[model samples]
Target: MSDGKEMRRPGGRSARVRAAVHQATLELLEERRWEEISIPLVAERAGVHQATLYRRWGTMPALLDDVVDEWSSTTAALPDTGTLRGDLEVYAAAVAAPLQDSLVPLILRAVVLEIRPGEPRTPSRAFRERERQLQAMLDRARDRGEQVPTLAELLEVVVAPLYFYALFSVPLPAADAGRLVDRLLGLVGQKA
Candidate 1:
């Protein structure tokens, strides 16, 4: 029976293509600035047609947004261990690990600072989502009778310093994670 509607083929081909493209993007990011990497370069690196990339990703910002989303999906997540301190320790380790990745600062700068011409500054809201996740976690602690401060306060005391040290190429002192977690807990009336 022939129907008017066309049925697309079902396969894992799209997944394979996305993996190839995203991996190629990571490789390119290591050697190229966000503005310098084009669709042709990504396609050549991935062994895919430029047209395919253009069709699939739509624009350079869109593609980069997707790449960053993939990276965050794989790496960035809030810790949900039974207690707040355990959760913060888990997140702190992640921050330290990624700070050493050469690409991390560059990617962070581009996503946070660069405004793509003719497009939204952030096609992905990874930063905002991360903040929201932090807020939700804090809200949970507050619900559990912990006196948590606002997210802004938490960031000022706990998160910003790590980022500052990372941006300046300073190695995180081994005690920094525990110290910051303690300070954050202290703000929430939880003595560590």
Candidate 2:
């Protein structure tokens, strides 16, 4: 993590280097695939020496993981409205707004280009983390006497379409988003 340069460390030199490296990685990712990005490129982009990037991240995968984790964590926490409908609407807005971000499409497109169909695809840690968040939301709803089908199914039926439309260039009208939310709450009500 030293990057061979003595950085003043109030927070510590390592933290500073990591932040710089992440910023550089994110900038590079906007224009190139992960495979095309090299350690030297990251170091150059960050204005650090190449050894520093290696010392901090060790490999491209490690660097990209840190970048994605940092990016994913920036989303605001979902609101907990009393009703399921209200909560879903708030959550939908949070989820949908991110879809409109330019970087999201770039990252998703990079991922798609990197993976071939029929290849065994590992689920991203972010995807699992999001599912966990949704599950927690479901648990909260249940605790509030609001029972619903498994959050996975509900998310697949509702939230997944928003992302799918964004990725595939399908038109996701506000009415469609509202209808999906209605269907999700309808399912919840039926289950209750």
Candidate 3:
């Protein structure tokens, strides 16, 4: 890479606009369902023009998608701590901290409760990204010679609890994550 100080995005100002709109969306989501929120309301709350929202995102689903993406961004990457225990702790923290965020519950509820018969499976891009990230983590564990199980197993054992507790607004027990990793590794050890 060329001593990277000069690369600039084409729409730096628009980034601020996007953040404003996303925040506005979250604020609106706190008070109303997606059906009740509108572009005009979001624009007013964000102090951005309705035309800007339309020009950038074009529709309600699209705008909601962006907001969800930003919120989900926290789950974008998992740390490659050399041990499975360390990795799972990082994962636990990532999943747990967002449960307290004003927006995570709304996003999770919409995904779990608001699906229509013919719509795409999950509108939350972050959920989809998390699946991919989880897979990578599993593969890393296996590559490191840890006795990891399938992604489904990991999900049921670890990720499921993370999401379940968060979605339900329950605080995770401090030892729960560590205990989960212990169970996971024990299963692997037993298998071998």
lDDT by residue (tens digit), candidate 1, 27-87: 8877877678889999999999898899889877788788777766667677788677777
Alpha-carbon TM-score of each model against the true structure: 0.79, 0.74, 0.79
Best by lDDT: 1
- Over 1-192, each residue of candidate 3 has an lDDT whose tens digit, in order, gives 142532455367667888888788778877886678889999999998898799889987777667666655644368888866678777776656656664456677655543445766544455668788888888887888777777777888887776677677575654566666676767777321
Please, what are the lDDT tens digits per residue for candidate 2 over residues 33-151? 56788999989988888976787688777777666666566654557788676777777766566555455555455445434356557766666666777787788888888666687
Q: Pick the candidate with the highest TM-score.
A: 1
What range of 10 consecutive residues in model 2 has the weakest lDDT sum? 1-10
Model 1 has a clash total of: 0
List candidate 2 segments past 4 Å from native.
Answer: 1-7, 10-16, 76-78, 107-122, 170-176, 190-192
Q: Each prediction's Cα lDDT score?
A: 0.74, 0.69, 0.71
Better of 1 and 2 by TM-score: 1
Better of 1 and 3 by lDDT: 1
Prediction 3 TM-score vs. true: 0.79
